[model samples]
Target: MRETGLLSLEAKKRHARTKIHGYYEGAFKFTRPVRLDDDCLSVYLIHVGGGYVDGDTYGSTITLGEGAELAVTSQASTKVYKTPSKPVEQHTKIHLGADSVLEYFLDPLILYEGARFIQNTTIEMEPDAVFFYSDIITPGWSKDGVNFRYDWVRNKLKVYQNGKLVLFDHLLLEPDDELEGVLQLEGHTHVGSFVLFHPEASREFAEWLYENVFESFPDVRLGISDMEGGGIVIRILGDRTQTIERILSHIHTFARRELLDKGEISWRKY
Candidate 1:
């Protein structure tokens, strides 16, 4: 069976609202939006039978008003199940106004054995706009019947400013594919990345992130590069989903307090 799910969030006048609309197995329709309490914006996902399963598609969009501030997070990691029919798909879109700020700290995505998934993220920003976003993916759950040898996941990210493309990221992973020659992965099963739209910052900050949070993980490889229009991209490859999630949370908190000068997101309490 094939299914589609839609999740969206929009911000205007510093007020953030979100909605989820879609059906699963043609038996039920899902609709709801968790409000952002303070700090910015956040949305909690709903689980079906304790997991997010096969033939599922989810898309979300977020917008920021001029001079407004917003933050978004997921209440839990997205779970992908294995089935013979099809894989799951996720898509996201974000927009930021001039002088506005957006920080998104998404939870990791867990892929089960025999599962295949594709995800895409697109961001549109105005000049002088600041934003931060990250994505993380983990291997199959080890405690259950799941295994890692047959799963696959792909991700694509694009950032634009003033209608001009600035940053493009394409990430793909499959057990059968031979990427051993490349410096990527290097025997790790979990991967995470952080992309920032701030050009005025120096290389010191990027270097610091690698030196501090990533210092202890020997199996993880780090990559830092310049994004179009003076932005920055940080990529990490590791073996543990919990480690990657922790690193992402650290970066998100630091960005919120140090970069945006706003406290931790209030909606997280709920």
Candidate 2:
């Protein structure tokens, strides 16, 4: 069966007064940021915006309005597994208008042994708008060489604002690459990341995320970097899925409170 999900955020100001717009509208323009529609089951978003199995695939899209600011997140952990037939695939697209801002707090994608999946995200931003995005991929879970085998998980990320290229990142994990190789996973199983944007972006915020978010966890390797549009990206690698999810949640909430002036808008497990 073919299945699809959509989330969108758009806003318009009434002479400088901001008002919420639609739950999901088709091609509209606005001045203030309005949370159009949020996909409640698997993904979470305050102002704006999947699933499983063998021989099946799912996709989603999120669009932002000009001058609107919004954040998107996943409600629960994303599980990617391998089956005898076909591997799972997920596709995401983000469109930002001029002066718009977006942040995504994606929970870790747990890849099971023998599982093969491909994930990609494309971000198109306006010239004056700020955009920040990231994705982290890790090797499959394995114990003995003869029992469990995982390989060939591909991930790609691209950012373009005002038609200008900002960031392009690609990663591929294979079973033969000396899992212990330098500059790779470094013996970590779980991987995650955080992307943020806005004018308040600074070196101070990056340092704060490292000390306050990553430093609190033990046995986790983390790093923070800058984006082209006054934003920051954080990467973390660990063995436990729960710990990695916790860090992602914290960073999501922190950015919402600090940048968007919004409170913690949570998701319910249904």
Candidate 3:
């Protein structure tokens, strides 16, 4: 069976405030949006499955109308079990209108032994819109007690601004082919990535990360660079999930202040 979710949001500029004008929810649901200053809204994504299984296919699309501001997060980590017949697939597309903003921070993703997974993401936004997105990938326990037990996982991302392709990133990990080489995971088990796109993204932001955020996490390996069109890409590798999570969390907090001129986002789970 195929599981799909659709979310469409529009902003209404009436009554001297910006709020959710209209929205539609499909298979995937969301908790009530927590309001914030300056027309910001935060919500948690909800799914009704224990985890993804073999031959499972899931797709979702999120659209933000002009001037809308929204933040989305997953309540819990995602788990992908063994996929013997067909690999589990996930696809997401996001659209941001002019002067809009979206912050999407999904919890860690776990892939068990013998699991096969594939993911594709596409983001289209206007020149003035901003997006802060991040994700972490972790290895699940295996009966053989061998690291890198999962079969394979491939992740691909494409970002477009003003209807023009600017960035394309692809990551393919094959453990059986010896991933400890220089260009591969390099003896790391957990991997995470943070992407920030804004018109003001520059080399200075990358320098700030090196001096402020990256130095705090001495154990994790990180790389930050500026995108061609205008944005930043950060890749992190660590042994523990918490270590990577902490590094990304710090970046998110600092970036929000500098990039969006907003305070910390309240992410209370309870």
TM-scores, all candidates, are: 0.79, 0.71, 0.91
TM-score of 3: 0.91
Q: Per-residue alpha-carbon lDDT of model 1 for 174-196, expressed as tens digits? A: 77545433666766667898888
Which prediction has the highest TM-score against the true structure? 3
Residue pairs with backbone atoms closer than 3 Å in model 1 (clashes): 40-71, 41-71
Candidate structures ordered by lDDT, highest first? 3, 1, 2
Worst 10 residues of 1 by lDDT: 22-31
- Cα-based RMSD of the predictions, in order? 4.3, 6.3, 2.2
Indicate the residue-level lDDT of 260 in model 1.
Answer: 62
lDDT of 2 at 237: 74
Task: Looking at model 2, report the run of 10 residues with the lowest lDDT sum.
Answer: 39-48
Among these predictions, the greatest lDDT belongs to 3
Query: Which stretch of 10 consecutive residues in model 3 shows the poorest summed lDDT?
Result: 5-14
Candidate 1 TM-score, C-alpha based: 0.79
- Pairs clashing within candidate 3: none
lDDT of 2 at 128: 62
Off by over 4 Å in 1: 1-3, 14-38, 47-49, 142-147, 177-182, 212-220, 263-270
